[model samples]
Target: MPDIVEQHGVPVLVCEADGVSIGTVQDALDHLIGAAFTGAEVVAVPSPRLDDRFFDLSTGLAGDILQKFANYRLRLVVIGDIGRHLAASSALPDLVREANRGQDIWFLPDLDALADRLGPDGAGRKTG
Candidate 1:
């Protein structure tokens, strides 16, 4: 049972897995909401290794993970080397690209990139 850490005073849940389950999301939401989270932002799941399979955001365990996020309005970030994913399916590549463009879902290359993009350092670094 991992606990959420306060990153810059924001509750951040570092997912130590391929993807998160509904139970995990519920627990996280409970923690954040209990801490008075405004639902505007949330912890990012820092991982390059996602649950097996992609494209269809329905059925299977991966779908369960996606559905949980979709239902909770929770922002998700899959930070890692997704080149393998890109090579596997064009739909996944497109999904990743589209998700990266949105504020809620992101497929970043790494944690530094995520930190820099989120401006967590308060240095006002430009997000590329």
Candidate 2:
């Protein structure tokens, strides 16, 4: 189950911390759409539910998943400590850094970090 919470005044669908990794792009899409249906402007997914391949740029899984979210004009936030993956691969750290710098997608250390990024008013205003 997921939680629909107001973060920084924005509605965000926060995925469960369950350790079930998303194995395919379809699964990712399902989650995104489901979140959107709940009127969430941003979908916050815990890192524990992401497949290991998602952390490997060469697999292209991350790109595919991100594209789907972008196509729907939904913001995707991957939260949790991905330090192990980052240390294992140089590209992953770079990718996370780049994503965090953008508004469309972000990879944050935790929910608090996300709240900080969203600021005092969340992502400016609420969205459907």
C-alpha RMSD values across all candidates: 5.9, 2.5
Task: In model 2, state the lDDT of residue 64.
Answer: 92
Give lDDT per model, in order.
0.53, 0.80
TM-score of each: 0.60, 0.88
lDDT score at residue 99, model 2, on the 0-100 scale: 78
Q: Which stretches of candidate 2 lie over 4 Å from their true place?
A: 121-128
lDDT tens per residue, model 1, 1-128: 33454445444555555444333434444543233243334545545334444433433544555566667756666667767657866467777767676666677776666666566653322245
Q: Across residues 1-128, which tens digit of lDDT does each residue of candidate 2 receive?
A: 67778876677888888834686898887765555677888888889889989998899999999888888878888899888899999899888887777787888889887787788645433334
**Which candidate has the highest TM-score of all?**
2
Name the runs in model 1 displaced over 4 angstroms: 1-3, 6-9, 17-41, 46-49, 55-64, 120-128
Candidate 2 weakest ten by summed lDDT: 119-128
Task: Indicate the residue-level lDDT of 126 in model 1.
Answer: 28
lDDT of 1: 0.53
